[model samples]
Target: MLISDLDCNTLKTHLSGQGLRFRTGPFSVSLRATIPAIARHIAKLYPHSETLDNDAFIDFHITTHQVAGLRRWLKPQVVFSFDGYKPFKPLPLAQAAAAFEWGLNWCIASSSHQYLIIHSAVVEKDGQAVILPGSPGSGKSTLCAALIHRGWRLFSDEMALLSAADGMIHSVPRPVSLKNQSIEIIKAFTQEPVWGERIEGTTKGDIEHMCAPDSSVRQPPTAIHAKYLVFPHYQSGCLTEITPLSKGRASMNLIENAFNFNILGHQGFEMVSDLVDSLECYDFTYPDLKQALDGIEQITSAKP
Candidate 1:
């Protein structure tokens, strides 16, 4: 059943008790929380995601509860626990949903070494996937949210799980988090009807989460061979330009942004090398989203 099927009270009851397990591509995450906002957040943001029937070897067991001591009544903070161990300090209770989102990402990036994880977003069209790698404030998430809403299939907004056994991208299409001014920007950009609450006062400033389309998240996970490796940069008043990057440079660049390049060692090297050799690499700069989307279509649709 989808998370949307459960009412707010029912969702809270499950989370406060047995936990709610949901599948996103290769991993299954079971989340529990007592924060009222969490249940509402999940109901809206995770409505497109399916809840697992039972915990048969769950990948991540996570929870959020009121902090202990005087602070529980004073400032009212929430602590996130993973396997009975608190990995992060207590955060303001208002940030419960963001804390949960970040915690799940940490779980995957730190432990899921079976796949060569990278800090990038993956989107596909006509069976061709474009891997986007960028630093913070690089507009990666904003661009990703735009593409998925436009027509492309969302692979992931935060992490790209590249298989070592086979050179294919695994989909982990969770909600795309928008930050700062981008929150209102996206609100004005699309009317797709999948935005969560506009949460404020996080370290990243005001933030919001947008759910992946039901069709994208419900499809069976398929291993994808990447077709484009584009490093996107959003520059105000700058004309859109797609500059080619050499395979040698692209490989090195990918390693710099990879979450577990050294962990995979030789296997990671070979996998990244193969990707560079197989796909077209480019540095894409844009001042406007529509123009950038146009530029992508011009390139991806062209004969390789």
Candidate 2:
């Protein structure tokens, strides 16, 4: 059964009691939280996600609760815990849902070492997957949001899971995070965007999460061989440009964005090198979303 199968009262009851176990891509997550906002967030954002049995093997066991003592009554903050250990400090209760999303990202990137995880946004169209690895403020999520709206399937918004053995990209589609001005930009770009509350004054500035497209969430997860490695740069008034990169340079760029290259050591290095060799690496810079979408469409639609 899906999370949508449960009513609000039932969901809250489960959350307050044991937890809500749900399947996200390859991982089984059991999330326990009493925060009403988080309940609403999941109801809207993850309604298509499947709820797992209670006895299932959970990959990430998480809990978010109001911090104890006067803080819970005074400022009202929420702390995120994994396996009973608190990994991060408390944040305002209003940001509980955002905290859960951030906490989940940490869980996957830190523990899921089976895959060569890279800090990138991945989307696919007609069997061609594009990996967008960009630094903060490089318009990665913004461009990803645009592509998914234009009929590309979103693999993930935060990271790409490249399998070590098969060299294929795995899907981990969830809510697309939009920060600061990008929030309004995407709201204006899309016809009807289902967004969480605008969380203000966080470490990442104003933040909001746009619910994943129904197609991206409902579709069964599958591995896709990536065709393009595009590093996006959103420059104001700059003409759309796509410049090819050498394999050597592309490998280095990917390593810099990788989450556990040193942990995997030689295997990770070889994986990055081999993946770059097969991909058409490029530096993509654009001023407007429309032009960016067109530029990507042209390449992804071409003969492989």
Best by lDDT: 2
TM-score of each: 0.96, 0.97
lDDT to native, each model: 0.87, 0.89
lDDT of 1: 0.87
Model 2: residues with Cα > 4 Å off, grouped in runs: 302-304
Q: For residues 242-281, what per-residue lDDT tens digits would candidate 2 score against the true structure?
A: 8888899989999999998988999999899889989998
Instruction: Determine which window of 10 residues in candidate 1 has minimal summed lDDT.
Output: 48-57
Model 1's number of clashes is: 0
Give the Å error, residue 192, model 2.
3.1
